[model samples]
Target: MSSRAPWIVFGSALAGYLAVGITLSLRFGFILGDALSRTAAAQAVLLSRDPHVSAIGFIFTPLTGLAQLPMVAFASWWPAITRWNISGITVSAAFMAGAVVMVHGICRDRGLPGRYRILITVVFAINPMIVFYGANGMSEAGFLFLLCWAVRRLIRWVGTDDVHDLLLAGIALGLAFLARYEGVVPIALAAVLVAVVTACRRGREHWKDMRRRAVLDAVLISGPGTAMFLVWITTSWLITGEALAQLSSSYGNTAILTQSGGASGDLVQTTAFSLGAFIALGPTLLVTFPLAVVLATRRRDLEFVVAPLLFGGVLAFQAGSYITGSTFGFLRFFICAIPLAAVVVVQLFPAAGDLPTRRAGAYRRHRPSCPPMRTAAAVAAAVLCVSALPVTAWAMLQPSLSSQQYALGYLLAGDPSAADSEATTARRVIDSFATERELAAYLDGQALPDGSILVDSVYGFAVLAASEYPRRFVIPSDLDFTQILNDPAAAGVRYLLTVPNEGRGVSDAINRRYPTIYDNGAQLYPLELEVPNTGADQPDWRLYRVPS
Candidate 1:
């Protein structure tokens, strides 16, 4: 493998994705609320009055926030980075660039020609799901980076019996959990695969000895991920008082999903819901998927099994989750299938120089029927990979398929009528960002002492991040947040920034504490301002004064 190939892929991808991200964010004012929330959480670590690592919040996995720290640190002076969520874009772009490099590595490892490697990598890089998530600063890009890294390492370990490869794969899967909660699916599947492969490798060994070897090898491959999983829960329990706050907290996933009225269908409906997303973004899965599964069974090859189980397992888990009403049917949710399919392409039709398989195949008698048949499949895979781009671009404009940014597609196509009221309003959505600035400006002018303005980072993260004086606000990340929230007036908190008690807003800390506070200040506090939500994807904010 040429060492320079990865750098070329990474550098080009980084530059191209950064350009798209920055243009969409700065030039067109397109940004994502989830991405902004991550940036806000990262800022809590360095800019909050408490200024502790734990300030990064516990609801979401920590690595994405932790990953933003380096860029988030600059937000103090480079306000635009946080204001426009540019720092998040930078992080996502970098991770996605790295993900593309992993896809390139798989192509090389499978002995694909240089041109085919370039084609596979390019197809993955230019996919709409990849480009959008890579620029949007969500955890998907980083999660994909870790997932792809782990997949390549797993394939290498399966072929070479390299402990180092196994360990590296395990470590990546471990960190992948910190990137996205769904990572647990891969970690579990990888362990099972490792055990199966290890046991099957024993030919003349004792049954007990083979069993022992299989168990140890499985543990070795999965130990890091298991440990990391424990560490994450322990950390969250310590700070948030709930081990799975990301799921159970009032401001957590279940609360938000319920509030948004998500998971609107039965099992079959949800399955179709998920499949539509997968088909739109990962059309290449159509061919590679069957080929991957059939080849592993036909050849009984452990190496070929890596693609279907390691990567395809995650895809299946997402589909299952949707079918079970565990996750929303988002286009980006099935993005890993893109790389899974690309890797399967290489596995299905590796060229003669595929070193790993060549060495392992010493015991095998199976071969392709003829070179022409293999060539035909390889060409078809490449064609599908290229075709996925336009197919995805078309899918991105359909709101039912591309829930997150389908409006952007319509807006770009100059068909504003095709988009909904929210989309029409979102094209000029910077008003909400400015509204946060205005609110922060008002709070900063009051010269509130530290912990004077009580707000939950769940929804108020935008205002907290926009403020020049973040210390003036007492967020959940604060060491004394619970104390201040209990009796704001007694705790010297002068103001409460709250959202109306409706939908997800009711889960906001303030609304829960004073259920009727948003309506009439609960007769205990005076309403100071009613800031109407001026942008899409945001709730109207209510500022109330706590009598001291």
Candidate 2:
């Protein structure tokens, strides 16, 4: 086992993936502090029975947070791994590590060169999408690992025409499908390619061979695959009386749209911008995909690598439906596939014809010689690594810098007597607690007994802040704050909070909607006076009395 020689490939992959994973996580992981999206995902889970959300009911709802129960369980029991940002960050990294080992083993079995295997593994490790998404709680990282493993297995089977490999490939694809619905596109593409190759080889004679082998592979893989999917479906059905209804509801919800024409335009803009962003990430990928097309024509060398690229493309296409302007997130969706494309590009460089060559399977084989510039290779690696520095640094710093700039804007425009007594209230608001403490403390001082408080934040805060008063602070399903202001029931709100920096237009609108009752200037607002309800620039809230 030690002499099998793929461990070097595994080690190199682990080291590179870990380095990129840690670097990205050091910044992206902690920015929200304890402000996890628990409400989004958890609410989906809780309301799994709601018809609108039922389409997604079978699957663990991501609207709450990134990690699934299985993922959380694994992280919790794993020694030296805490179930927080850093630990959760390792989930995708660990999956990539396993994928690298699997791919290395498969390549070694195919008698690919050790050096080549190491090189491709490194390429996979540094793949931008892989590094970015794998460290995130998002499902894309796990899906990529499963999809890549399946593709490698499928290709290995096609190259060798081994039933064991074929069956394993099916199982891997099946698992990939369970991980992400988009995985089916890649699996179908792979199956079609394999079937076509088998048919052309011996005509009718090959037909039977292909059918029998494919059937056996499908049966073997489908056993576990079907079971995994059924579990989610059955649970969703039991909970919501329909399989995937939560997902369907979540997918179909478009109530946020202000106008149909505007929404349609937004969708078009999203698709165009997403495509532009993907192209910008690497114009080389558009070129590289054609190489995949050319390579796919080689029946014996049929790498299922194209499957993932196709699947990613399919997912990218779906980004058009996202009305919330989340198209930028699609870049991370295609990140892992970029490195694979780079590796295939590297493989296309023809081996020097006149160089010293060792016949395949020679023990301690002669290194394929003739490239005299070892320094050039080292320089190339250094250049690629350093080239990413500017981007990595920019991505890490942009959020923090933008937040600081935003705080400054608020500070300058904010009124001292209305918001807070001090002029520096804006900075204090920015520097204050990263958790629910600030909002909770402000509510506690109001002494209003058991009624909803409206705030523009994710629902998790609403739940946590109101834990002492169950169902007191419900997230208004109808987000018409204008209507809430006029309604007598809402006019008596005990505590009104605004995350002026985080919400869309709520920051500017808040100041415009309410008169300043009392302001310390920056944050401490105590309502001691009333003024006309004219929509002019004012403090965040103007409390109107409810006549008894």
Candidate 3:
């Protein structure tokens, strides 16, 4: 195979998806909130009144925002980048396309035929959920990329016992930890697999030797990720005085999940919801996963052990998190399962030509005496993968199944009626946050002084990022935020943006300081305007003119 084949696949995939991302932004106003919020944080590193590195954030892993920093820093020159969140879209599309390259590389390392590699990549790429995350500027795309990269290297290390491959895999996961906290599950699992595999292969009689080498290899594989996690928490603690702030902070994942009522469903129902999500995106996982384990057990083909388990472990961890009230019931959490299926499919089928030399416990090209049955099996696997697309598309359109996916689904559905609804709250419900943009524009027109507006970033990140004059507002990241929140009028604060004190809005600083601020300005300020919450997904915002 040409070394350039992966680059060609990457460039072609990137170009196509980057176009999809741009069109999604321009036509339907489709963008993910987490992406927007992360991009806002990235832009605030320089664009905010505080303009410090700590402005990036304290809780959620920072890689997604750090990846956007370069493009976000340029947002001043290209206003559309931050406003439309093209910076995030570009990062996601490029990372997703790189994931396509890793898919090809994984298949190739197992010596699969070119045609099979291309087939698996296409089937993986065409899944609507996959493409949506790739083009919509979410962390899932980057997480998928790093997950595949780690799995690919670990597969090689398990096959060849190359220390270099193991080290690179650890670094990929270390970076993945920065991408999403879910990376911890796979990193920990990978370390266990390394230790167990080493013990079994390296020591037949010398138990002590086996234990020592296994422990060492496990440390080599696990060290980087563990260190990264510790450093991240330490940094959060140093900055915010709260370690694991993502769980304890008012703006953290648990807070958001509790606030949204997402954790209120019964465990059995949520488990059922999880299985349905997996089936839609990775139906092949049902068949190929078992096949990988069977093949690994029978032929000592350890490549299958590392790849499937790394991806599968993450999926299990996410499903468990949702069931236990630790996270939201989002279909996107299962995206890793799609690539897991792709890796398994490529291994299940025989290549067009056998390898010149085979490594023991590596991939064994399955050779069935009945050639026709082999072809039939491969065809059936491919069919199972392709069939998932329509099921995934159907699932995305169902609000009960995927409220996060509805706007893109409506646009992709291509119904003229659905497109028309873009203006009627269908698109703006979550993605557009169109009212926030209108508020930003309205506020920009006023002669508001610097530090005149007081709003909590938890709810006001979008409006602040969208504003042409961002520094006019005094946000939580500002140094004097605590002092000013106590008595805004005396601190030169003029306007206050207050959301209804419900759900996630309960933590808003303004609401906390004066519980009746939104309803009656707590007898200290006057209501200037009320922006009705667009889709009932967010709170109705009340703008107050503080008596400064």
**C-alpha lDDT values of all predictions:** 0.79, 0.43, 0.80
Flag regions of model 3 displaced more than 4 Å. 350-374, 412-431
Give model 1's TM-score versus the native structure: 0.91
Evaluate model 3: give its lDDT.
0.80
Clashes of each: 0, 32, 0
Question: Model 2 clash tally?
Answer: 32
RMSD to truth, every model: 3.3, 10.6, 3.6
lDDT value for model 2: 0.43
Worst 10 residues of 3 by lDDT: 351-360
State every prediction's TM-score relative to the real structure: 0.91, 0.57, 0.92
Winning candidate number (TM-score): 3
Which residue pairs clash within candidate 3?
none
lDDT pick, better of 1 and 3? 3
Cα lDDT tens digits, model 3, 390-491, are: 877888877666768765545654334544754344545544567777788899899887888999988788887788777888888788899999988898
Sequence-dependent TM-score of model 3? 0.92
lDDT of 1 by residue, 148-170 (tens): 99999888776667677778898
Who wins the lDDT comparison? 3
By TM-score, the better pick of 1 and 2 is 1
